[model samples]
Target: MSSDLVRFDATRLAGMIRAREVSPVEVVRAHLDRIEAVDSRINAIVTVAADALGAARAAEAAVLAGEDVGPLHGVPFTAKDSIDTAGVMTQRGSPIFRGRVPEADATSVARLKAAGAILLAKTNLPEFSYSTETDNLLTGRANNPWDLGRTPGGSSGGESAAIAAGMSPLGLGTDLAISVRGPAANTGIVGLKATHGRVPMTGIWPRVPRRFWHVGPMARSVRDVALAYSLLAGPDGEDGFSTAGLGVDAGVGREPSRPLRVGWLVEPGFGPIDPEVAATVQAAAEALRGVGCLVEPVRIPALERDDALEIFWRLHVMEVKPAFAEVTRGREGEMFAISRAMLAEPDTSVADFVRAEQAAERLRDGFADYFGGHDALLCPVLPIPAHAHGLSEFVINGRAVPATHSLSATVPLNVTGLPGLSIRFGTSRDGLPIGVQIVSGWWAESTVLHLASLLEATSPVRDLRPAI
Candidate 1:
């Protein structure tokens, strides 16, 4: 029974709770036990509610009264600290925000709570959730469960670590660039960034122009990702850019039946992919074909000379600089290295920011045109697997690559305001995990999940638990 409960997915757990086969208390206890056993080694979590037992018991009593349980009943989940959690220390990994608490929940958190999912706790993230690596001045660093020496990934690194280590069944991750997919890629979990504004960003920090920022979900399976997404999606009234679309459930039981036409690319936006990544993508293509789906290697014309990085940087600077300037006003030493550099930029002028925003609008228009035909485009989530933590720079194919390009494929999707997700495609020869992104154009999460499900059915990454 213990093994069965441990192995149950969120969808299965919800069913068990609804059927009275499992109580919310039992589910929460099991997860707390798991977290207690693994969290110290990873430092993935900074807070845990000891009275979670009381909450779960109350949930069980509500269920016994025949209350209409939300779709995610009895599911235990965690979120990155970058997001605000009412009553919990929602520090964004900076001492500047140490012990800071919000008076209300983030819209995403409110939605999940409304869905009957337990908010177990919040996980760590990079300082201000800025850097791709998930270490900060507050909670130290998150170690990869697979290899303790390597980073799990970041700014959702703590969430990814917890999910990979089986400390939590589902986690909420935000992806401005690789916050969701990076840790997902490094930790061998599913990370999803729904279309820009698909989910409300009202409570996330530095909520500026709706350009590159996105809130996403990370879990062990694509089905879990979709389930979490459905609960968190739709408009919250304040984030005017958020979609008012109907949210669809895509759990294991609620999965689509048809195979999708998956158009994929082994090479990323600019050029050739890592040999291992290319091979894995090809293997996924073969697996898709075996499942009676038509998979083809296609070039995305939008991937060429897009100036995506420039647009993203310019827009981010314009928004973030002012927000930070208000607090750190004149305290240039208080900003992170990247934020400091961005603050120093005189190039992102009022004229330049306007033009960049217009360019971004054009990019979004082009993506909408491309997704008219393809269900989803499959590509490497990152150019390479998890590198050693704090490597300062990346050396891709003998070229000194910029640190920002470490997770290039997923970021451009953010810039385009499209929906993208990372799934564990394959493992490296050394056993490190490789991730692949299935990107669907703006607000088209259903297609992305459909293709991801098909791929998962074919090339399944088996339960390779990180040795915590």
Candidate 2:
């Protein structure tokens, strides 16, 4: 019964709970049991909520009493450690902030709780949520469920691993360049990095580089992500970026009035993509074309002109370093390697900073131009499948590239504040998950989620699960 319960997505669990076919206690217990059974191997969970079962009992009582409930009523969800939970320890995967617990939930976490979802646990991440791999001094490392030797990707790696392993059905993850989407791609799950500021970042760490950071949902299904996004979006009064008013349409199951137009790309701009990963992107484009959408091969000149990864580094490092320095001020000895590496990066020169700012604008303008003729743009999420833990470089298409090159396909969307979703559509020759990215113009999360749902319905790899 626990096995069956853990297999269901958040939407399925919510429906079953609502119908009284399963009680909230049973659902929560199944997940807690799953975590105990699998988390030691994965190391995805940092701190399990002490009050989770208590909360579940309350939810079950409410359901039995026939009280009104929210859409995610009785469902259990996890959050990356970087996202604050009212009483749960949010260690930020660093020793500098060890034993730290937020007095209040982040807007995202509070919103989920308000929707009647119980806080299941807090997941792991890189120290200060800065690295592309999920390992830190505090929680050690988070291993991918598919192959324990590989990573699930980071800084949202632990959240993706937990969802893929069925330890949690849904969770929240923040993305700067590739945190959410890249990890989801690595783990064969669905992750949404909604338009920047669509969801408030009020309670997440490192608020300095706010423009590039985004908080969104990561789950086992596209519909779950869409549902969470609907509930999480809108203004929170505190986050200046989250000024978008309520009532944004999620468009999960809705089809467009006319055939949607999508363009697919794999190269020249996004650096070197593996043949398998590139084929996955093409397959997704063909699948959309097969579904009667106007799909074609296309390119955005700005990505080719100004390297998005370079631009992101130049702009974000300048903004993020100070915040890191501030938090680690007196505790330099407790810092992790990634944090040290970040601090060691030379400051962005005035001339380079100006150039990067202009290049970012060009990237945004380039996407604007492309979206003028297409509703969505499809591309590879990463150059390769999940690499070995602690790998700092990779060889793609017989060419050597720095580890940061993996962010190539994703950083463009961050630079433009565009909404992007990563969904598993193909499997690598190594038996790893490969995902295709679907992106849309600003404030077009509806379009992104709508198209993702269509793909989800037709995905050949839909039923695949990690052997773990």
Candidate 3:
């Protein structure tokens, strides 16, 4: 029974709770039990909110008392540790902030709670939520439930792992580069990176590169993701960048009038894709075509530039340097080893930042031009499937490249502040999950999600789960 509850997505659980078929306490307990049973091996949860059961009890009483409830009332969810949780530990997978707890929930968390979602726990992340692999000196690593020896993808790795492993039904994760989408693609779930400033980021850490950062939903199903997206999006008037509202429904409506036009690229003008990964993307394009969409191969030449990563790195490093410096000022030894090394590196010059910014502008314009003709771009979220632990670089098609290069396909959306949605499309030969990215123009989340839902209805991996 507990296993079944954990397996049900948030939307199903919400309906059950609302119908009085299940009490919030029962729902929370099922998840808590699942966490206690599975989290030791997964290490996905960093802190189980101490008052989760209390909140669930209150939800039960409210339901019994006939109080009006929100769409997600009594549903359990988790937040990435990098987001403030109001009395729960938000260590950010770094010893630098070890044992630290926030006094206020991040805007998204507060909104979700207000909508009647129970805060179950905080999930793991890379140290300071910095890397693509979720490991740090503070809370160790979050292993892939699909293959314990492999990674679940990082920054939001824990959230993805937890949701994939049925430890959490839904989660909140922040994305600056590929944080959320990478993990979603790696873990066989749905992760939506709404347009820049579409969701408030009032209490998420590493606020530098503020314009590019986004906080969105990561869930087992697109419907649940849409539900959470509606709850969390829009400005709270606190974050300067979050001034724009998410102007459309959470991509839950009908298909477009005419056949949608989608452009796909497996190589995506970046890293070499493993043949299997490439095959899955090709299969996705074919599937879109199978579903009555006009699918074609289109390449944005700007993405092919070798300097793309350099520009992202330069801009990222410049933006985060102050935060890194201030945090590591006297407590350098407490920082993640990678972060320490990164901070010790010499800073980029003004000329380099300026050039990178200009490059970013060109890249953004290039994508804008591409989107002018394409409703969405279909591509691989990563060049390869989830990999083994402690891998510093991935050998794609025999040539070794920096592991962070995995972010190549997804980072362009971040650079342009466009909305990108990742959904499971197919699986690798070894049974690991493989996903395709659907990226749309700025504020086009509804369009992307609508198309993604159409694809989800036909995805072979839609109902699949890791055999953990």
Candidate 4:
């Protein structure tokens, strides 16, 4: 029963809980037990909520009293450690803030709580949430549940690992470049990097480069991600960037009025993509076409002309370094390898910063042009599947590339402030998960989520669980 409960996605769990077939206590305890059984091996969870059961009991009482409940009533969800949780430890995966607890919930966390979801726990991340893999001096490292030697990707690595390993059905992960989608691709799950500022960044850390940072949902299914987005979307009036009104429909069960035009790509733009990963992107395009949408192979010249990953690094370092320097002023020795490496990088000059900003605008304009002719874009989430942990270099399709190249496919969306979704659509030869990215124009997350649901329904790899 516990195994079955753990395997259920958040949408199904919420339905079952509302139907009174599963008690809130039963649901919460099952997850807690699952965590106890599996998390030591994965190291995904940094802190389990002590009052989770108490919250569950209260939910059960409300249900018994025939009171109204929220969409995620009694369902359990987790958040990356960098996302503040009221009364819960949010150490930001760094020793500089060890034992720190927030007095209030982040807008995302508060919204989930408002939806009746229990805060299951806080997951791990790299130091200051600034690395490609989930490891920090505070929480050690997070291992992929699929292959213990591999990573789930970071800074949302622990969140992806937890959901993939059945430790949590749904989670919140923040993405600056590839933190949310890359990890989801690595672990074979669903992650959404909604339009920048669509979800507020009121309580997340490292707000220096607030323009690039985004808080989003990572889950086992697209519906859960869409549902989470619906609740987490509107502005809280605290984050200046989140002032945009929530106008997208979320489109879980709706279809487009006309045939949706989608363009898929795998080369020239996103650096060296593995052949297998490229094929997976092609397969997804074909699947969308099979579903009666207008799908074709397409490319944007901006992606090929200006490297999105390079632009991201150039722009972010200018803002990030000063913040890191301020936070770690006297505690430099407490830093991890990733944080130290970031601090050690050559500073971005004024000329370079201005150039990158101009390049970013060009990238956004490029996407705007593409969207003028298409409703959505389909592409690979990562060039390859999950790699062995702690490696800073990689060779993809016989081309040597830096580890930061993994962010190539994802950073463009961040640079453009576009919405994108990552869902597992294929398995690698080594039995790893391969995810395809679905992106749409600004404020068109409904289009992204709509197409994702269609693909999810026809996905060949749907519901394939990791054998952890």
Candidate 5:
């Protein structure tokens, strides 16, 4: 692959378009070609805009007439199915959401359009964005671009796969925990879960998770993620959760000149670590050292030896049950068996809900105090690399792990209401991608990206495309 053709970093694409070195039509054609060539094997995108060429022509015409194009002017992008796009069939990968189309776009989607981005397609997701593996009844399972046998990670799996396969320059992924970050680890890309409420969720279907959900960007480069984020963050009045007008800054371009005071936790706070996962994280730490960052092993005080991981799971089940119920009602739409099973066993009660909320408060407070001095917290995104879908449900090291809550490290960041960024570090011994997750304090997205950009600058994972 020629570097110029395959390189679709948001910043670079924006620059070339701004300089008129490339036409919007050419950019769209390149992406469309990639999708046609690679999406068949991965099944990453459920819908490709039929009008994409015409839209690109309009953008190209604007450029020719010397109209001021927006920052993302004519750049192609994708969003998970759960986010509504006008006139498009948003099959949230469920039979229920099958034909569901919103009259308007989600705020983030609107923002991207306002900034000159062209909406090209809706990526696949788990049923209702509920699971870790991207298998749903409507769109089928999304494969990892790296190894088709393994999963591309969950909920945002399609977005990760699509971006990794070079079908889109940027993607919008809502992280209800591991949905975004996990797939980035699995597919070798950057996925970010923005600070809660930083991006509006108004047009997002069944927004009951209310507290835990976050919408952010995924891309091949930290700068690309950061650029997309700058356009997506801030408030839209419709979402009560919008953190607009807070005088908060997006904080791009702030780089530390010297070694960063970084904290590392090898243990997944409490869960099991596949040996290869641990070594990959440690290797990333060593690489950071080479980049002038002081990496130190540190224990997170927020995580108790008890069931802190359980607390996140219970809370997730609580948030998930109602939303899942709303969509899968009457079995009206084609629902994934996983979603059907989850609905049948909706065991989360009000007591569990209260306890989960309380635990979350405690978790947030603990991290608030802990990050008072550190630049960022780096850890493994998953214990094991991408395994077959149901392996965790069986047994790992003879421990009866909850098949669904395998995303323990990632859920904590969501439950704690902090921003998290996942950067691909290296492949495990089995050749599955390994993700190093960097979590930051509240509204500290800029700091998180600063560290992520450094790692991207120093590591080889920045452009490790799966040779499909």
Candidate 6:
């Protein structure tokens, strides 16, 4: 039981803990031991919480005392280093923030703690959480659990890797472009980027471009993602952008009563997809069709527009980079190469910035029209499977595309402030995981979760675990 305990999702672990099948202390110890054994090769965890054992002991005592327990009572979890953890280093994967500690946990972390979830460790990310691959000067690179030679997608790479390797059952990861979903897709786990404001981003690092940035859950199963989402979603009164969903369920058992209209796309207007990846995504659609959904292949013209990536970049340059310019003025050399390069680029003109904003508006409106006729949309999470550790670009199907093209599928939802989720559904010929992204209208996480849950039910990779 101890050896297999790490493979269970948080939902299952919580139930076992509630049934007294296992003690909280034992659960935490099993994971800590697993991390100690495997994390050296994966570099997933940055800092193990010094007081994790103490927390577990207290949780064990509560269960023995027969006190009321929270839904996640005693389940151990990890947080991306960018999310604040009181008295623990929240270094944002940069040498500049080394030794930094927060006086209080981020809103989501505090809520998780209050619900009795024990924090076991903080995971690694790319420096400033800006890149797609999780590597930093402070904590180093987080390797993919599926293949050590491959990468766990960034900036939530460490969180995904740790969960895939069973070091932690659940974690918090932020997403702007593909931070959460991309990593989940790459690592064959579950990741949710709820409606932009569904989860508050209070206490998260580099809190710029508030409209696009999001913090959400990553877990081994969609049920666990739903469980964490229930606790983490809602306005915290601190983050203005988090005011949309004040109290939302994680949408676990709320399956749609009627047949769902699910639109799936393998092309999605994003140029160049690996044939294997497209087939896996199409297979997900078939699974949905098997589950009584009206799954159809469709395309979004706005998303297909080649300018979508350019628009996302324009907004990033105009809004996000300038927000951090003051702090990074003298320390550009200390940042990641990607971050420095982005900062070094010429500023966007007012006309271009306005055009980009309009493009985003078009995307939001386009999704609105598309969702009016469909309950959810399914697409490939990435054009290709997780690539080598440090390749800047990947050649997909036959076309050589820029590495940042990885964001093409995800940024449309980000631009629209809608909900998007990634769930593992298939495996590549090389045994790598492939995931499909589910998107829904603004503030429609329930719809997204419902479809994702359906897909999860029949996914061939549902029970698959990485050979880490």
- Lowest lDDT block of 10, candidate 6: 246-255
How well does each candidate superpose onto the true structure, as a TM-score?
0.92, 0.98, 0.97, 0.98, 0.93, 0.97
**Candidate 1 lDDT, tens digit per residue, 1-468?**
654565567888888899999899899988888888778888898777545677788889989999988998768888888788787778888767778988888999888888888889889888777778878666888888888788887789999998888778888888887789888989898888887778888888877755567888888888888888888888888897885565432221224465566787865464446778777777877877787666788876666646677788888866777776665665656555655655677757799888888877777776667667666677888777788888877776677777677656776787877778888879988789998888876666887787778777776575666656
Candidate 1: RMSD over Cα atoms? 2.8
Model 2: residue 153 alpha-carbon error in angstroms: 0.5
- What's the lDDT of the predicted structure labeled candidate 2? 0.92
lDDT of 6 by residue, 245-282 (tens): 63453332366678888888877476588888898888
Q: List where candidate 6 sits over 4 angstroms from the true fold.
A: 246-253
Residues 12-32 of candidate 5 have per-residue lDDT tens digits of 887788888888788888888
TM-score result, candidate 4: 0.98
Between candidates 2 and 3, which one is better according to lDDT? 2
Residue range 1-468, candidate 4, lDDT tens digits: 777999999999999989999998999999999999999999999999999999999999999999999999999999999999999999999999999999999999999999999999999999988888999898899999999999999989999999999999999999999999999999999999989989999998876669999999999998899899999998898898997766644332366688988999998798689999999999999999999999988989999889888898899888888888999999999999878888999999999999999999999899989999999999989988999998888998788888888888998988888999999999999999999999988888889888998889999999788898
- Candidate 3 per-residue lDDT, tens place, 26-71, comes to 9999999989888899999989999999999999999999999999
- lDDT over C-alpha atoms for residue 138 of model 5: 77
Model 1 misplaced regions, further than 4 Å: 1-7, 247-259, 330-338, 350-355
